[model samples]
Target: SRSLLKLLEAKALIELSNQTKPPQGWPSSPARNLEIPPNLNPDQANVLQLFQNQREQKEWLLWGVTGSGKTEIYLRCCIPELEAGRSVLMLTPEIGLIPQLLERCQRRFGNAVVPYHSALSEGERLATWRYCRSGSPCVVVGTRSAIFLPLPKLGLIVLDEEHDSSYKQEAPMPCYHTRDVARLRQQQEGCGILLGSATPCLETWLACQKPNNSIGLLHLPQRIAARPLPPVRVVDMRQELADGNRQLLSRPLLERLSGLAKRKQQAVVLVPRRGYSTFLSCRSCGQAVTCPHCDVSLTVHRNSDGHSWLRCHWCDHRDEIATNCGQCGSTAFKPFGAGTQKVLEQLELELEGIRLLRFDRDSTRGRDGHKQLLERFAAGEADVLVGTQMLAKGMDLPKVTLAAVLAADGLLHRPDLRAAEQSLQLLLQLAGRAGRGEQPGEVLVQTYDPDHRVIQHLIAGSYAEFLEEEAAVRRIARLAPYSRACLLRFAGPQASLTASAAATLLNHVANQLREADWLAIGPAPAPRARVAGLSRWQLLLQGPPASPIPLPSEQILRRLLPKGVHLAIDPDPMEL
Candidate 1:
């Protein structure tokens, strides 16, 4: 080995080396794929066998719809790895659900079960990360970034909710989809990979299409009761508002909520944002007072300074509430949008003596915040929970028989093209939260655009129809799940400088990028456009090649940059 190394080193192609092999009898095993539980579905058995028998590729998209018993199927795939004494990392959308997943992992693996999440202290996270690497047939339950967890014998990787946008990492190091990263790692290490979701991202589905099919597609569509999907009722908000329904709860929804309460069934009111008011807008000028630091609108929050602050959402820039509107210097300013706090106040007045719980970044800021709130809600201590998009992921509650999307319209209003897909996913996921137990569940979706295709499809429970319509738009617009996207953002104090830098950077990118092969948009200023006093500008790139090209983002940083500009390359960005 030393001689071989010396020969290779002489060729001047060496950086560093830490070659090692698995422990004795570590990975040798005859195919046990057919050993699936006798009662397991044939499709489930096929999925397991694909992992056990197919070694040519490392990734598998287990496209199981809600209540498809995908979790059980995932368990089947994990059996072989566990038997071989290898570790598994299961990634979920949020840590709020981590405890629930941990319960399942523990129930199956007992003391062998291990968990990791951002909510854990740094030391605890580090310890668990180290422990997984130290060798154990452990299962690590965590959020998207948990893909980086180092395990000595990684035999299987499972990404629950593969289509969920939370898989797109926004901060910290090695910012990449836990799903994609897991696939890469599995390939590198020759382990099996699984991507599970109720609404599989088109990218994953398309990737698995036969070569003649790019990859393979698998499905588990029916509920485990195999009971039917819950009934979804769409309430048009336009007419409801014209009748003077202030907080926008439709009459039918109010009646349903009353019935649920009387039946002792709890419900959820979903408000997609936190805080009282996102911004103070001028009634006269239609302009909002924004934060100078971030390239976005300022949030009006009551702070300890004895006054309200216009706080940047991305950074810590703050300005006291304005006496005059910046646009027209109009004194007639008003809170234009509703957040969780506003929704909470309205729901309290609208409903009877219901015990309400609120969940959001602000509410879950501390270490144990997520755990405590989730526990209380799960224990049925809260009759109603009001929250931001934080509550829109995979959370199971048997008693939550009714879910009122106080406003589903917010999902449609986004700079992202996956807005419709995201909107549908959130609607379905939130709706799934209801009727888990014996009592059936119902969803009340209040949307002004009731006729929108996505809303219509969700209301009718026609996922296939929705996919076809959505795929049409994506193919036309070159949006995702069909192609890959890279976002480059430049941020700094001066808007002009940031814009100039961003434009110049975009020019360089346009020159370097293969024009005929890729799509490029902007060097335009970002939507939020500023944060914590830094002006932000962005460039969005879309590619459809068989292989992804590493974006030239860092190279731009290496080049001469405008003084205060910053750069972020978000592949498959969730937000603009």
Candidate 2:
């Protein structure tokens, strides 16, 4: 309360009598407070020129390569708006990125840069929101929730890492995407929208291809230092099995890690999951232990003392390891697949005397855990950093001379249409983490499907070829990029009620489907049929590109849903 009041007092925002109007005049141009102009390549210069030339609200995709200086372009482009005495809003995908981004923004714009995100205390959030609303030229760097901030004089909006799924909000009313919301705000407020990503989402790429004139695509194909993209070595797990080397780390990765450790160079190990094991099964009954509240099997987690426990990732439920199998009353149990914890354990055993730091949902559960772990890894306190999906995006560790993906197969074979694209993006991003500094870096991807197209693309480091091949498949399947997609999920405590509610909604949607180009699929059980004791079902909607697909509004849907049942509608969903 004291902090909030003090801030309010400083701005004279607490007393109506002392409230003064904003400054008498808004500067027509920036004071050129940036000590020096950012150096830009020809391609970056062209993109910056386009952004500066936009007099009206427009949307553009800055599709740059992994180290192609996209952030530099963003910083340069945003300056003009700030100079014109208008606020700029920049959005990143995760809280883990806010610290680094905030640091850079602060260095560039000083106190004018306001950091807004859930990580801040309520007073800080309110102060930032009020500052942005003070009609002063400033920059607001934040996560998805920052979209709703009231920056009335906003002139430029940026969505970094646009391909990331974190931009999509899954709960509460108006579950809108950051990119979409930014575009909407641009339309309403007459601001320029810039979407930057190394591996652009298929939808955004396709949107850029549409001859909208106002929407442009800027390509930055080369890294800033002209460093050659790291060479990705695809290790076939099948070959390892045939060679009688059944280890999680491939021979090549093991050798590379050994060399890295010997040289005191840092390494990053990318795992697909977080717990010690994906699932555990009873050796006697061949039955997998499942979460009591969720349909998914319980993951095996081990504490520092090495005591094992079962945890439900969906509901945060914990259970002790049973001495006997529930089904057959047998003592033996077996773990199914490896996760980050398992890989960390294996690395310690295989590469002795290596200092390893683990970064994942479990390990980084504390408030400042992400920042602390990353700082330690960056400071050379740990030789190896083991993580899951969190390590794939927006993390630039220059000291990371070696990067390895334990298993790419975990990302593939998913029931989602964009699995292939996601897998490719993830591999390429992980590969890009290496070779960013003086020492040449390399990536080793271990996968069972060495012949897979995604693996082939990674090995070649040809994003164009991968996109063309993936686009062709998407076109043939009439899935995203070629079409617009939406997901409607229904969940309830009772299975019968959930099914009934889903069926009713499906029938209603079908009856209301007047457009011939629109299609709806499924009222079937979702990928995970039950979560937190709630039975779930899903419906998919697809329509022609750029066409609007109408459905019940939040108010109407809330009324239609059965008691205890809830509905979640995601337009252009990242997952099926």
Give the winner by lDDT: 2
| Residue pairs whose backbone atoms clash in candidate 2 | none
Model 2, range 171-206, lDDT digits (tens) per residue? 764567888888889879888888998888877776
lDDT of 1: 0.73
TM-score of each: 0.85, 0.91
Top TM-score model? 2
Residue-wise C-alpha lDDT for candidate 1, range 1-576, written one tens digit per residue: 888878879998775576343221112343233323437666666666766677666667777656667887777677778888998888888877776777666556555666677676666676676677888777777787678878889888888888887777776534577776876796688777778877777666666654754355667767666656789888888888888976655788767766655688888888877777777888898888766654467777653343566666677676778788767778998886777777666666777776788888878777667778988987878888888776767777778888888767778877676787778877887877777767888888888898887778888887766777777887887566567777777777788887788777666666556754777888786776655666778888778745475456476554747655667667677665
How many pairs collide in each candidate, listed in order?
24, 0
Question: How many backbone clashes can be found in candidate 1?
Answer: 24
Prediction RMSDs, each to the true structure: 9.1, 5.0
